[model samples]
Target: MGRAGPAGAAQESSLRLACVWEEPPAMGTCFGLPCDVDSRDEDSSQTLFFHPSTYGSKIRLYESCQVAERIDSFHDGIIFTSRPIHLHERVTLKILKKEGPWHGGLRVGFTSMDPLEIDASLLPPFACPNLVLQGRTWAAVLPDVCGEEDTVLTFWVDHRGRVFFGRQQGVQDILLLKGVPVRAPLWAIVDVYGHTKAVQLLDPTRLCGDAGEPAPPLSPFQSDVLHAPACREFHGRPQGCTEPCVICFSHETSALLHPCGHASFCYCCAQKVFRRSGLCPLCRGQIQNISQARLGT
Candidate 1:
């Protein structure tokens, strides 16, 4: 990714201050208690990014760790904010990219567990039944339409510990999950799964109605394949022709297929397959795009 020069940095600083005077919308009441509590003074003083240590193995952090992307097989991709958000502190993110062969969309919510205190190796591969079943975690798969690239989402936890998420177009929001035990500080959690490939966390100062500007494009140099095991076939001649790419068997396995989520073709072989049948060789699922799966950093 290209590093911003002094001029670019100055511009971004101005943009960040542009919305400081703008107030967030009033939140809904939960169990007769006021939900719109303001802690912007404390929250805005610190930078927000994905915690470096407590993320799943398939996840990658980028843009100074403000963006999260999934790689490899697409499962094992979960992340949490670096710090716990204050009550009604709206957390906003934009869908940077999406790919398919898989159903469902992004999942967002809150968790009471401190990320620093949890073991990353023990983190589940998913959020729905995997993490949520463990208890203090609450999340919901977004509507399929929300899977579209550039979709801006804002979510927060209310005073009653109910979770609500919605598009940033207006003040409207849908209750995602409830019964969260908010006795402890709550950190925002996101599952970059299925069709949702990459996401970028926006500044809390950028409110729903305030910023009309579109999400910024990611750095073209950003890489896929974070922490991926070195491909044996890609490095040297296949020993006894074992585990060669399912297609040509001449090179390392590359391009990952959507829906089927299979990684069985090199870039060249994938292009050939895409041109010939446009279907996954194993499952025969329709092809969407050809590329090794990884996101952000």
Candidate 2:
């Protein structure tokens, strides 16, 4: 060419650079070959000098450049744009960074699905779906045999989404009694977690009704049991002694109220006594509930 223009010169420079960067190594190239200027050596030198075809193909370089440009454009959201992810698509998020103290780390954002929704379709097939039966308790279809009837049963779903079911008696309650009929709506089921199973039994007619009267006040005896003595004595003696007495007090001042009725014990003693017999340790009376009895200061 007599004189190349600026545009042609720039294109030539780019082609040279691409060829240098993308060319493959020559085949049959020997390392440490002596060049003593013999006939064979002269012949090889001539071959190397005149073999312009040995530069391989320059078109491959252009192809590689084109491919690299396409990749870069795709990564920058220019060539291939991404579609929005749908909610139904199962997504997982990992925590790359967190805020707040170690004891209570406040999660700022999750790398995957953070706050998941509690929905029926999201639950497992074997999972006992969460059902609110009465009060603040939550019920689930029993995964196992609870009792004679399996219509409404108690089941627990842990934080990790594991399902468990049983008739833990003192530990759990039946959703429906033998003679009683549960008239709860299907939509009342709220929580699927295992913490509190008490369901808020609602009546559609009483949706706008006035607040009901407060529960009846406890009797003095019931109040005494409610504020029962500690389970253990100050000296560590068991409060229930040998019998499961209702009003047994521990030395530590912590009270233990029997689950069934007006039975009480100290915290230390009650802990020991309740282990063997959940019932009223002394009177053989059935314990309906067990709780820490608080004495009036």
Candidate 3:
């Protein structure tokens, strides 16, 4: 070539750099690896906040997009996450306000369609039976136990695409609905409908561990990944063996969580967990009752 343009010269220089070294000039990364690894790591640790633009007309965002409140009407309180959530990523929300005169509590679930793609004006006043009926959307009204003001709730989608709900201060998440269609990436959807008026997003890091404290409550997502297979072993106690509770490591395992049926705690430690988070330390299943582990079990 007689003369290389500036763009061509830049491309040639990049190729030369690539050939000269397996890694770019950066210290920690290779040529093919993303240079923004730190940014991605930061993002992975960031909590999910309310989407600023993709929400219902009646919904008002506040506190740097951490709080979402229904302004005029209860029905138009639909809102979504700032970005798509990963599978099994637990989303936590606190009820800031409630409308007692209204008939229902909050309705929450997931949708396969992107909220950003849908016009906010086109979103229905309610999430259930309206958007849910349209297909690819699923939502269930939270029971009154989960709707009290200041109550913190956590919801997540399992690998099966089933949606589960729970209270941070109460029992573990119960199955809200199952068979959520997995066509596209899912976005969390919440309708501050009925008795629910306003909700706030909670930072997940707070649940991971606290500063200068003992090990934080085992994260449901983390436990789900680590001990899923071992959790099944709790269905029955091994003969002639006394396995200590996972939490205390002092008491023999005794408590049995309901529905999901994972028994991983002693009766005493189980009570402590119930009083704290009401979740199974092993499977994160809702601890409905703590029964004595049967001799055969």
**Which has the greatest TM-score?**
1
lDDT of 2 by residue, 31-60 (tens): 223332212222221100101001111101
> Candidate 2 or 3, higher lDDT?
3
Q: Cα-based RMSD of the predictions, in order?
A: 18.1, 36.3, 23.1
lDDT of 2 at 236: 28
lDDT of 1 by residue, 1-297 (tens): 112233344433432232122112222222222444332334455656776456777776655467777865556778898777877877888888787666555777777677756767799887655776676666776776677887888888887877788885556788766666554567899988767888888985653345555445664544433232232222223344324353333466556666545564566767776666575543335777766732111
TM-score of each: 0.59, 0.16, 0.55
Ranking by TM-score: 1, 3, 2
Q: How accurate is candidate 1 locally (lDDT)?
A: 0.63
Q: After superposition, how far is residue 175 of candidate 2 from its true place, in Å?
A: 62
Angstrom error of the Cα, residue 259, model 2: value is: 4.2
User: lDDT (CA) for every model shown?
Assistant: 0.63, 0.23, 0.62
TM-score, cand. 1: 0.59
TM-score of predicted structure 3: 0.55
Q: C-alpha displacement of 137 in model 2, angstroms?
A: 50
